[model samples]
Target: MSKLDIKQLTKQIIDGVGGEENIVSAAHCSTRLRIVLKDDSLIETDIVAEIDGVKGSFNNGGQFQIILGTGLVNQVYQEFLVQTDLSEVGKEELKEIASSKLNIAQRILKALADVFVPILPALVASGLLMGLNNLLTAEGLFVSGETVIGAYPQFADLAEMINIFANTAFVFLPILIGFYAAKIFGGTPVLGAVIGAIMIHPDLLNGYSYGQAVLDNTVPVWNVFGFEIAKVGYQGTVLPVIGAAFVLAKTEKVLRKFIPMMLDNIITPLLAVLFTASFTFIAIGPVMRVVGDWMTNGVMWLFFELGPIGGAIYGVVYPLLVITGMHHSLVTSEMQILANIETLGGSPTFAVVAASNVAQGAAALAVFYLFKKDVKMKAIASAAGISALLGITEPAVFGVNLKLKYPFVAALIGSAAGAAYATWREVLSVSQGPAGLPGVIVIRPQSMVQYMVALGIAFVVTFVVTILFAKMSQGKSKLN
Candidate 1:
């Protein structure tokens, strides 16, 4: 869209939202302009939808979002700020406003999002490194049932080095989770890290070998007041550290309130560490560990036991989860899966995500051609389609597919089929990355070909279904 067009559309949107006075705060993601309105009833949804550049609009998390697609959103948002004379206070304030409107459950999920969002970079890089190492060491690259390490013995040390680099994140995952969770729960970040370190102390037996230790009858324990507490390291566990962080943060806060300022710094840290560690090792750690195991077993049942049927169900509901913003919780689940990548074989969830994402992209691509006569829609669909293929789907979803009912349904069908096939084939990613075609880099060496084939099936299915649906709806005219 042109500069003039953006400015004009911004004006119309402002008027539709009952002007600058009604808008409390504003933020923009890749595809939509998110605005917090002081008076919810003041905004005119029909008027906003009528605007030329708007692909779609909705109310989510107490924010009114107007979809304008990739590059165009930033332009319109800038123009919006200019027209309204609104300060660039940004997303933080919007988050606060949104939080106040959320229920207890939503707030809890938001906390999880906050704690995990910053950790993605480290995890993503590690995953990619691991993927590369897997490729380097995998068998059958040149000959059937022959290993790469055998072919190139000189690179073995380098591959082993890469493996160590990749394992660092998962090995010390609790420290990362604790520090962030502490920050989120309003505690000392360092204290959280300290508690995390305590959980994985060298003297303690590793959690990964807990089963083996039990089988061998070598599980170590500390007897305290007639109670036996196991000393198992939570190396790759998530929930235990999070619970420990919360306890640590709360303990520090309470201690500070009661203890005098003169002795506060020294006594507070001392008591906080000792108490948090004792409680964590004794109560919180064991309890959360059991809960975490339940979660692990649940996911294993869905993604492994049910296999293709599970994949289909997940694919079908994935889009719905995205719409509700509940998908953020899945990051924690993926972490658990990826943490035990050695044991789990592969991440079926990532494969399902890729299928779902690419299916949406394909649906958008079909729309781009279908609406070629309309310049604004064609631009929106084309940009959204490409963006979705790159692993970001909000643009394609809200901007094109979701707005057009048929394409969304088509994408769902494609996603289900692809996920089922991929799961059945046992396709899995080595790392967390984009779900688009470009995401192939993260696929494990053995599954790269299978992943590509699955995604190709998804693309074809979505495109064909969209075209057929659109043609069927041509006379009925209920697309939007």
Candidate 2:
């Protein structure tokens, strides 16, 4: 059977939906087609849902979503941009469309950037090296005697220094998040980082370590009320710093707007710093800690009750949380769990999630291979799959699987299989690892072989299943 010309099919699909006239805005994520319209009333979503290549269509967060699987979504997006009037929409209109009260994409995008942008460079460097390192270490190229070369006295010194700077962002994520949060809220990011630094100061951490309590001793410095507060280090934390930064940014903005210039310059910084720090120490930190504890305990209870199945279910839900931008809320909880409990056994859900990401990448690759006759589709699929494999799933999900019709199902099935296997095998991840190749190390060193095998099986299952399904349906003609 001849393959559907992806570009032509995309054009037809767009034209059927009233062309560029109907579209107000459009974007793609790892697995879905995100679109806003001038008037959804003018388009027939049910009709679009029944299109030859479209998997499904639904309205979410005020955007009309067309599920396109993984590999083909980018092709469709590109074709739409070329063949439709959406390309003609002015920048002001695009911004207005994006900022329309009903749209949440901007905020979601910002949050995603906040979490991912800072880590990207380090992630890329470390991820590629980590993969190569695994291969080298496995071949005994980096081994010294029975111990790894990293354990050698000469190598250990340099390795520790590199590891420190490379891993510091993750270790002190709260400070990074505080800076970004301040930027998001229209505040001085540098100031917010300084504030975050103070919260995580070594001296304060030492005080907390010594079991010191808040003492009611006021020491005024620069007209700001200073009281010795109980300290809880914010390094690698998520909630307290973010919460503090959010309040501080708003306070600073309001002060800048209303307070007289002379007083504003001096008084605003003092009040903002003092108030934000005080609130963080006295209220936000404790509350967030309690909340984090509760979440960890709740997940732990579920793990105890449902065992591996619960872990599998969590694996499935975690990605969906990432899609909705709600995953940030759980970062603090996961860190707290790591702090209180040495291992993530009680929360082994990410093992399956890691598999899911790999599965999605595989499914995308399958589509790329299947639609070889369509050069544009093939190119987009390859790029999307590679991106997914590297832990950047937006392009894969928004660009490929959702567009290909059957790949999303394949990804889900693959994830379920991986989750089930990991749960049954009691696979555990110790650290909060990347969702891609580096995550392979999350498995216990002794069980690394089993982890790789399980991951391979999941990817193969998803890829083969999706390719076969797509092949079987090739001869049949369907309408958009």
Candidate 3:
């Protein structure tokens, strides 16, 4: 068999899928090409799946997806953008760049975006309701004696449920991430989730003390093979579990291949579980917890040194982080900040970040209005924009902003402006929450008002800019 050049194979795969002409818009989930087609009738699903580098093809939830393994999916998507004429109007000059000084940073930012996309909606809805709960509770609406309308009574229980669901994701998110990591590593998700569950177990939590001394003047008290171990918590974490699961999966695979067939099924699983669990508890978790703590300390250093400016910078950078999936790296830091501060009361940049999402959504809406003739693009734009307004930016950013050239620029502009205002005002949040407009209410009410004003200005700026740019660049070429 001839060895296939992956680059050439990827190009061929895209060409086979209606040659970009049949593609309406293209985005990605974790491991699949979530493509919208100009005409589904033109797609030859079987033939596409048969292509050299293609994994599989399927249609679900009104999306025609082509599955490709992790790293290759984005490469294939880029190939489509470069080889085809799907470039949005006015942004043709920015297409097909092979290298740049900021390439590393850009890649990192894109990773952050991807990691947060799947969890955005749930985070937003919960954060929004959480903020509302605070507002209603403070205003004597929920527990007040004087009330003509029973809106408070009807919503109180529902609000509590939403709050629990939203916070639960952050509290136990490691388990969910571990499941996905396991799948990525070709291991059983259940096994990985069990590892995460162990890390967060009550016994483990009760055993670790934050300020306990592990060493006295360089002489270690706690030691594993003469190495001092740092005591730390692993709840709501990411890297440690993922790294451990990968090792476990590889070990499982190796054991299955080498062990005698008679003992493989029972003995392999038992060994895999025992070894992996022991390694995690005795080694990986402690090491990773130290690393996570160091990272939190670094972020805190910046926060204290730069104050609101640091937050504004974080806000401006966060969306790009979301794009690349590196945002997972920040989760430990954010959670630590919450644990330390107990409230977002000292920093206002959270509100700015939330506002930027609204701006991105507004930009999408602008694209929809400007591209009236392209009904499919219009619908996608509308859906994405509306979703963003409601605090879900995955559909807007991945489905629309990045695809439509002007929208991303609009979002950037809005984010920068909003961040600047947030920094200037010194607005502070009362709690940590999702990145969206409704989540802005987590800030002190007075600060939230200022944040809302900043967001309003950002929305207008982004909307106007996107509309003007879209109209100015109209008729250059359609997305299809």
Q: lDDT winner among the candidates? A: 1
Judged by whole-model lDDT over C-alpha atoms, candidate 2 comes out at: 0.63
Residue ranges of candidate 3 with Cα displaced over 4 Å: 1-180, 201-208, 212-233, 298-304, 319-353, 364-384, 391-407, 420-451, 464-480
Indicate which candidate wins on TM-score: 1
Candidate 3 structure quality by residue, lDDT tens digits, 47-98 = 7745654544554333566656577766766666666656532211221121
Stronger candidate by lDDT (1 vs 3): 1
Give the per-residue lDDT digits (tens) of candidate 2, residues 1-480: 013487766766676566777776777765566777777677665567456667545553446666676777777776677666455444334434544634465454434345445644553454334333333333343464443544555655554555454445555556766787777666778767877787777765532232233353422122225644454565534566767787888889888887889798788888888878877877887686566557777866655568767756765676576556565555545554443322343235556767778888888899888887977667667867876776666556655776665897788777777767776676655446676655666554544565666677668888989977886677454531
Candidate 1 regions off by >4 Å?
Answer: 1-8, 18-21, 29-32, 39-43, 55-61, 68-86, 215-217, 475-480
Each candidate's TM vs. the true structure?
A: 0.92, 0.66, 0.56
Estimate the TM-score for candidate 1: 0.92
Whole-structure CA lDDT of model 1: 0.86
Clashes of 1: 0
Q: Please count the clashing residue pairs in each candidate, in the order shown.
A: 0, 23, 21
Per-model CA lDDT versus the true structure: 0.86, 0.63, 0.62
Q: Candidate 3 local accuracy as lDDT?
A: 0.62
